[model samples]
Target: MSNQKDHHYIPQFLLRQWTGEDGRLVRFYKPHATKLMAEWVYPSQVGFEKHLYSTRNPSRRGRNWLENDFLQRVDSMAARSHAKMVQSPVVGLSDAEMSAWSIFVRTLFHRSPSGFKSTQFHSIRIWEETVREIGPRYAQMKGPDDPETIDEYIREGINGAAYDQVLEHFPDTMMSSRVGQFLNNLHHAYLR
Candidate 1:
């Protein structure tokens, strides 16, 4: 017997996309809901936390971890993001919010126990090196800590790091995982 309440965060359609190569849902799925899940997911209709597994499941410990470290960070970033947007025409949220949310989601995906960790940031490091080889002093300038610098570069058409160039020069660093493919595809999507 399974419970639907554990997985109320992720939309069913989005959840369906995470199926394994064996054509079955990954083992991470569950149905537990957090009280604040609605507050976190609010105004958007459904209360969902896409990358989180189950807040109530003891095996996952999602509620404890999120309430402790993850959501705290997102909330802090959201405040800063909201502050920056007050002056910009970027609408909804300025890049601060967008970047913060992106990082939070990406981090959650990285921390996820069963599925989202399938393709992590470390798994795509080769692509960054390959990108450096193609050109763009930004990679060297930003150094090791700031990965979002690449996103900043893409968002800025002023630099030589254009979308077409990234696609054309993307490396073939396949390590027997679709993670390689996802990184390449992510570049394409990230640019847009």
Candidate 2:
């Protein structure tokens, strides 16, 4: 999937979502220290969904603005608007998810030796120790002569479970409000 250039949205959206807060997304790729670096650690060429979502119709009925050629131009404009409006945008993670996602993103950015927890939860350690514990496993799993790639190596040892488990330790109310809004949006968008 990674090599297939056509499947752009999944990675692009995930990467973008990592950075954007609420309605705003980033236009330029900045370093990790910037809070605008939210969901993604890398700069990505904007994908078609972002392009489609930003397009508008010419007021002629029955025309699919989503499929229009002019959309690309609009996409650039939207990207710029997104960048300008969201300069230093902050997407606060729930306290539960906060530490976990921070470490997850940091591990991705640093490319430090670490693996995701798959079987059962491990003790939460300071970032440095966490990397140390994970270093050996990462070394074992990472094959000789394998090229280092964040997407390939860090993909495992991580799943919804890792996020969910850490998140479970947090009081439900901490995220219930956000989850409720997400569910409501999902319902309206898909089930309506």
Candidate 3:
């Protein structure tokens, strides 16, 4: 596993575009959970959370796989495409460049702190609904050794390995499907 802990929801490359002559971007935030205020800070310092993208389950790719293996690649590709878009016209972009930009934009909507929380919420809701539907069947088949009630079954089952697997894999799977749909529906055109 990598020692990298801090993960940026907003890629530094995107944030650095707003940097001033002082090499720092103006960050507006609610300080102390009160009124909003602005502070000049490095992009790296402002848009990250410790271990935000770290997965509890360690795979062959390592614990930081999502951050290192996935988001980093997305950011890198988008950075190249963004540079091209800035220097030239959008209509001049190649298919790959447009695809990269589209993927990045879609990713940004789901990778932010709020977006991640919402994804987690939906995943849990789906799991809960599945458990409720299956609970009666499971209870009927369960032996004396099994958990007594549906709630007990849920608590034990969901707090174990199954829960980790669902939480870890579902969001990535959902994002992949959404990206696939976005790419399939995307059309290319140039306006005069």
Candidate 4:
């Protein structure tokens, strides 16, 4: 139900750093098979896809929950960290700032179209393997209304619904957990 439609995988604050005096950055892309195109466009105009992070499920909190709730917070924190790093790359960041920047970098990767595709491919592969391995064990626990066999359960009940759930939520979960691990294991030292 959220009003936001455009979601930027690359944060505007980061892109703004490269903007020209006219407040637009030069964007280049292939417009067609025979043409390459370039234009001066606002950062907001180039980096977003409409409803890229939107969820279709009515039971969820909001359609734009990922964009409005999670990404905005990450971008806000990273904006501060980015400013500090811009001012002084080596010495400006505190431990918290470093952590924020790390999270932002990792998030930027996972949120981009290419990264999302890659993650989706891997996640689906993993999920399919997991379901194949565990689906039979859980078949005995099925209620009267459920599919009679594990194979039937997988095909008739689990495939579409579970795949959608995994596709919708797994990237966020993976990003969060990986960021936590990255922060926990990170060590900083100055070498002369």
Candidate 3 lDDT over residue span 91-135, tens digit each:
356767777777787777777888866876676667777778876
What lDDT tens digits, residue by residue, belong to model 4 across residues 56-167?
Answer: 5533657777788778888898899777666633466776777677777778768887776677667767766776787657767878887777777667534455545654
Clashes (N, CA, C under 3 Å) per candidate:
8, 4, 0, 0
Superposed by TM-score, candidate 2 places the C-alpha of residue 182 at a distance from the truth, in angstroms, of 26
Model 4 lDDT, residue 130, Cα = 75
| Runs with alpha carbons beyond 4 Å of true place in candidate 3 | 32-34, 88-91, 139-150, 156-163, 166-192
lDDT of model 1, residue 47:
31
- Clash pairs (backbone) in predicted model 4: none
Sort by TM-score, top down from the best: 4, 3, 1, 2
Error of 1 at 165 (Å): 39
Off by over 4 Å in 4: 88-91, 134-139, 144-160, 167-192
Please, what are the lDDT tens digits per residue for candidate 2 over residues 37-84? 434233245432322211122233222332232222333433443343
lDDT, each prediction = 0.39, 0.35, 0.74, 0.73
1-192 in candidate 1: lDDT tens per residue? 123222232333333334556444534323565322212222222434443432333324333344334444554674465454444454454334565545544444434434332432333344455655646666667756545565554344223223223222212221213553343334311211
Q: What is the lDDT of residue 72 in candidate 1?
A: 45
Candidate 3 steric clashes: 0
